[model samples]
Target: MIANFSQYGIKKLFLPITSVVLLVFGSCKDKAQEKPTEAMVEEVGTADGFESIFDGSTLNNWDGDPTYWRVENGSLIGEITPETLLDANTFIIWQGGEPSDFELKLEFRISENGNSGINYRSELLDTIPFALRGYQADIDGKHRYTGQNYEERKRTTLAYRGEKAEISTQENASEPESLRNNVQRNAWQSRKVLESLGHMDSLKTKINNDWNEAHLVVKGNTMQHFINGILMSEVIDNDSVNRNASGKLGMQVHVGPPMKVEYRNISLKQ
Candidate 1:
């Protein structure tokens, strides 16, 4: 009787201990599986069924002024001189009215502290100085940050690098102390809440003072901006310019103190 009682007690203790060890091991295995791999982060260039717009030798298909845009060093160079800006009313309007959905790629270089941008879904405005109405992917040559959104002629920065930091700081500042503490304690769980409430900011950083690659993809109502292969921002094109299905495309040689900007590799995929 004594021996049986001892064996029973040992079995009871061992079963609970074994169960806990198995639970911990299973949890660790699941965590390892849940971690993302490197391949998922890398973006392969364009998928299939896309066409290139620029044919390298000439602007055969593109319709724009040769004075403002010239073929220099095997790249399409758009010069923003004072005379060109004043006399020609310097704007390169792609004669091909507008594309409902397309992808655009270009490489740009600029002088120090220069500012330029690409206008899409824009119209030629003789009265208004700007592109009138459209979306612009901003290029700040001095700051190194590229591919920022200018929606409907609004100049306020819609997104930039360290955006998430700004959002979190703002949220923490605005929320009550009790809620803040809860947010801090359960951050992972609160991701859905933050995203749904427009509290998550973008992760796009700037690329200062050099040649940078800018990629834009517009499909139906969605638009995405990328710099050096990193996605910077995205917005829905529900504005008036987009409603027309097609309009003029312009490059902004922003009015500033004698700064120069250059553009090359102007290509598109339909």
Candidate 2:
């Protein structure tokens, strides 16, 4: 009787153990046989009431020189080699739509010689493909020109960094003025100079060589530039001769040395 009871106990334990093993193996086998799920494509979404301009995977609504522009790692990349040096500055014009009273934001990184800008309320030049002629939030790898309000192919240098000036076309009105770079506050020490004026520094320190946030707010004739949450420059464009009310948006790759610039997370609200 004891032997019978022992045999029954062994059978009971073995059956349960075998059942568990079979169940686990069956589950694993079923999972393996199931088709692998396809990866979901990322859906680009708007941010802070701003609509996305670049899908990050394709240049669906951007127009530029294909040799220098591409989408890589989710950034709009513009690169040029010494052999592909351009004779004039070019742009990747945004085709999604033009903006008037709007705010534009994006992230950018440029090589040491890279010169680029965010052009808004700009018109395309018939002389050059993808050329813009209007307001540009100027940027340079040297941090000398970054965060300045420039008018491309128009009244150049509307306002410089660390400056709060009003520009008007009226002969009696105050013309474009700037706090010219000084020895102690030269391009290398731009941040210090701006800090002295309680403005966002244009020093390379505020910009990560890898990536930095650039924000442009344009409402009517007043435009503002900010970098990494710091106000770098502002322009009250009362220049009746050159100020634009509305036009296309673009990204520029200035003609000079061989350089590269990457931009992503571009969004605009109108």
Return the TM-score for each candidate structure: 0.56, 0.72
Model 1, 1-270: lDDT tens digits are 234547568654546777768867997999998876666433334444455656556766655557556666766665566564533234455655576677888888877766677777666666754334556677766544456565333323433322221111223322345344533322211211111212223433346457788888878666677777876666543333223355566676565545566767777677
lDDT of 2 by residue, 1-270 (tens): 234547568655556777768867997989887854443222233235788889999999889999889999999999989888998888999887788899988999999999999998998999987789888899999887888877787556766776655764534222333222211222211211122324445344676777999999999888889989887787776656546899999999989989999999998888
- lDDT of candidate 2 at residue 72, scale 0 to 100: 98
- Deviation in Å, model 1, residue 108 alpha carbon: 1.6
Worst 10-residue stretch by lDDT in candidate 2? Answer: 182-191
As for model 1, its CA RMSD to the true structure in angstroms is: 17.2
Report lDDT (Cα) of residue 89, candidate 2.
Answer: 89
Clashing residue pairs in all predictions, respectively, total: 4, 0
Residue 52 Cα positional deviation in candidate 2, in Å, after optimal superposition:
0.9
